[model samples]
Target: MKNVLILGASGSIATLVTRNLIEDSRVRLTLLVRNPDHLADDIRYDSRVTIVVADVVKDTAHLTAAMQGQDLVYANLYGANLKQQAQAVVSAMTTAKVTRIIWISANGIYNEIPGRYGQWNAQMLGSTLTAYAAGAKIIENSRLQYTLVRPAWFSDKDLVSYELTQKGQPFKGTEVSRQSVASYLSALILDPSQAINQSIGISEPHTDGSKPSFY
Candidate 1:
């Protein structure tokens, strides 16, 4: 069985990933959320899930303890202090001797996105992108085997079709569904060889225009 620990388990994308993994009897999940009460009843009561209530930015001791024996760590987290939180997670993972991690970052972090859409995205989300960049750097420098996913502007679409661009390439397209992001991450957890030690940019194929379709 693969023991997985999901940080920020209550977030939208993480919730979707949780739903996808819960049905598999071979996967064991430990959900770390700031507020356990916010989790859906089905998730909170799932026999395969262990809910840990604590802040990822603080509560280092509890977080490290929860990381013990985990085969994989998926961090779907964001905030102004995202870099600090990522550092904490890395430290905890090191203490627990867990080496695999999948971290969610935003597109445009490298400022390699081309065209007017890229400009608009940078203008609107420059600060948050900067934080994400720093967070990604911390993970890259760590000893862990990490996959940093930089996803395009999110859509509420139900489809999972998407494309990938490697780091340093111009981020393709403007939008990808949240479900697609979750699905890709889930697949990586099941098979880590596809993109180990790489940063990938995810977007829906041919969705590129002047801006995201959802805008």
Candidate 2:
């Protein structure tokens, strides 16, 4: 069985992925959360799920302990201190020799889409992109086998399925469901043979029916 560790497992997108993993019998999940009581009843009841409560920013020792013995570490941390979170995870993973990581980053970290939408994304998320850039560098420099997924604007709507654009390519479309991104992250954790050691952008297809819409 594959043991997976998820940081910021209490967040919306992380919670969705946590539920998906719970239903999968082949994987054992350990969640790093700030408060175990904050988790839903159903999740707290699952025997396969292990919850480790610690403030990641303040306690690197606890974070390191929770990461040990896991096959893959899935991260969904955001905000200004996101870079620090990434760095901490890298340190812990390296200490444990866990080696594989699936990180959730934003779309504009590689610069915007290069047009009108690009300008809008830059104007709206410029400061946020700065944090992602730092986090991205951490992943790139680490020895871990990493797959960084950059999702377009996140939506809570139903999952419509999506596509991927590898490093150096930008995904088209405005937004994607959080469920969609979570689903893809679950897939990456389950199947490490695809998109390992790379950065990819994921989004829904366009209405124009163009060829290869995402990348």
Candidate 3:
């Protein structure tokens, strides 16, 4: 069985990922969240799932210990302390010798995608994405195998489809469902060799063949 640890496990997208992964009896899952009480009851009852309480930026000792013996770590934390949280995860993983990390950033952090859409996303994210860029840098410099996934606007609706592009290509399509993002994250966790040390952007397909949700 593969042991996987997920930070920010209470998040909507993360919760979806957890639910999907839990259906697989062979996977051993651990959730590191601020409040374990916030987790849904069904997830709490699962034998394969373990819950740990820890704040990503503030706590490291227990978090590091919890992460020990895991095969991989998925980090989906956001907001201002993102970079610091990434650094801490790196440190813990480095200490524990857990070398695989999958991080969820957002689209347009690179400024490679052009026009008003990219600009708008950059502005919408504000300083949070600045920290995201720094976090990506830390992952790039670290010894661990990493894949930074930048997803476009996410919604609760179920679209059931998505696409992933290489780092340089502009992410295409409209808002992807949060479930789709979760599905992708779960896939990355299951298969690291295919996605290791890469940055990917994800979005849905559009009728006009142009990526939507730009504005």
Candidate 4:
């Protein structure tokens, strides 16, 4: 059985991944969330799931304790302290001797989004991308095996249609479904070698435009 730890477990995409992973009999999950109340009863009561309520950025000792005996850690947190959170996660994982992690980041952090959409995205995100970029850098520099996923804007649509772009390649499309990101994350956790030590971008197949359709 594979032991999986999910940080920021209450976030939208993380919740989807958590629900799907719990269905796998061979996988045991440890969910770390800032608020236990943010989780659904099904997740809260599952026999395969262990819930740990603590802020990853502020609770390094608790985070390290949760990392013990885990095979993989998937981080899906978003906050102003993005860089500090990344540092804490890397530190805890390193201390626990656990390797392999999947990090959710933002597109355009590397100026990989092209043309008008790139400019518009930059204009919209501004300094927020600076924090994200700094956070991603820490992950990239870590010795832990990691796949940093920079996804286009999110959608609530149920479809899992999406495409992948490597780090140096231009970002594609305008948006992708949260379902797609969650499903892809589950696949990576199930098979860790797929995109080992690479940073990737994901988006819907043909939604490209000046901006995300939603905006």
Candidate 5:
């Protein structure tokens, strides 16, 4: 069985990933959230799930302890202090001797997005993207084997179909379903070799436009 640690477990994407993984008998989960009370009873009570209530950014010691014996760490985290949080996770993982990680970042980080949607996204999320870019850099430079996922703007759609763009390629599309992102992350967790040590951009094929289709 694979022992997986999910940081920021209460977030929307992480919750979906958790649900998908728990259905598989081959995986064991450690859910690290800021508030255990926020989790659904089904997840809280699952036999294969272990809940750890602590902030990954401020609880380095606790995070390190939780990383012990885990095969992989998946972080679904973001915010102003994202770089610091990434640093904390890296330190803890190093201490725990865990070698693999899958981290979520946004599509605009590299300024490699094209067209009107890219211009708008950059103008709107410039500051946040700066921090995300820095955080991605931190993870990329770390000794751990890491896959940094840069996903397009999130959609509420349930579709799992998506496409990937390698590091140097322009990020395509204005939006991708949250479910698609979750599914991709879960697949990576199950088989980390597919995109090891790479920063990938994910989006739905031919959905490229000036803005998210839902808008």
Candidate 6:
């Protein structure tokens, strides 16, 4: 069976993708989390699941151990030290000989969004985008095969309707459901080659506005 390791696997999208993988695919999962309590019982107790408790940025030894036999490493993480986390993961993966990864990032990191919404997004997320952009570069420069998924503002909407825009193209829509992003990530688990060595923007079909509808 394909072996997958997810760093920061307790987040909303990561958890959803974790659950979906358990039900829809036979891949063995290794979840790295800061707190085991953050996981659902389904994942916490699954026979095919292995929980590794450690912080992605602070625990290099544990992280390296987790990547040892992993076929794909998916990092759905965030923080002030995201660039540092990228450094740690890259070092560990190289040591373990794991070569493929999927990283979750935000859309404005590339300044690819347009119009009033783009200005607003820049004004709102500029500080956060700096670290994200730096972390993305760390992954991009690595020899590893990587797919960076940049999503629009997130929503809790239970829908899975979404579209994509390539890295150099303008981003679409103002918001996308977390479910849709999870669905996209889940698809990547079965086919890590789908977006190899590329970055893609993902968003809902036509929820464009001055800002995300909820905001």
User: Can you give the TM-score per candidate against the true fold?
Assistant: 0.97, 0.92, 0.92, 0.97, 0.97, 0.97
- Candidate 4 — which pairs collide? none
* lDDT per residue (tens digit) for residues 73-151 in model 5: 9998889889999999999999999999999999988888988998888887878998899899999999999999999
lDDT tens digits, residues 1-215, model 3? 89999988988888888998998877899999998887888887678798999987788998899889999899878778777888899999999999989988888778755666666667777887798888887887899899998888886666678888888886665467788888888888787776888998887666113344433
Worst 10 residues of 3 by lDDT: 206-215
lDDT by residue (1-215, candidate 4, tens digit) is: 99999999988999999988898988999999988999988898888889998998888899999999999999998877899999999999999999999999999999999899999988888888888899999999999899999999899997999999999998999799999999999999999888999999999999989999888
lDDT of 1 by residue, 50-118 (tens): 999889877999999999999999999989898899999999999999999999999988887899988
User: What's every prediction's RMSD, in angstroms?
Assistant: 0.9, 3.6, 2.1, 0.9, 1.0, 1.1
Q: lDDT per prediction?
A: 0.92, 0.82, 0.82, 0.93, 0.92, 0.92
Clashing pairs in 3: 173-211, 173-212
Please, what are the lDDT tens digits per residue for candidate 2 over residues 159-191? 657888887775576677788988888888899
Which portions of model 5 show Cα errors greater than 4 Å? Answer: none
Candidate 1 TM-score to native: 0.97
TM-score of 4: 0.97
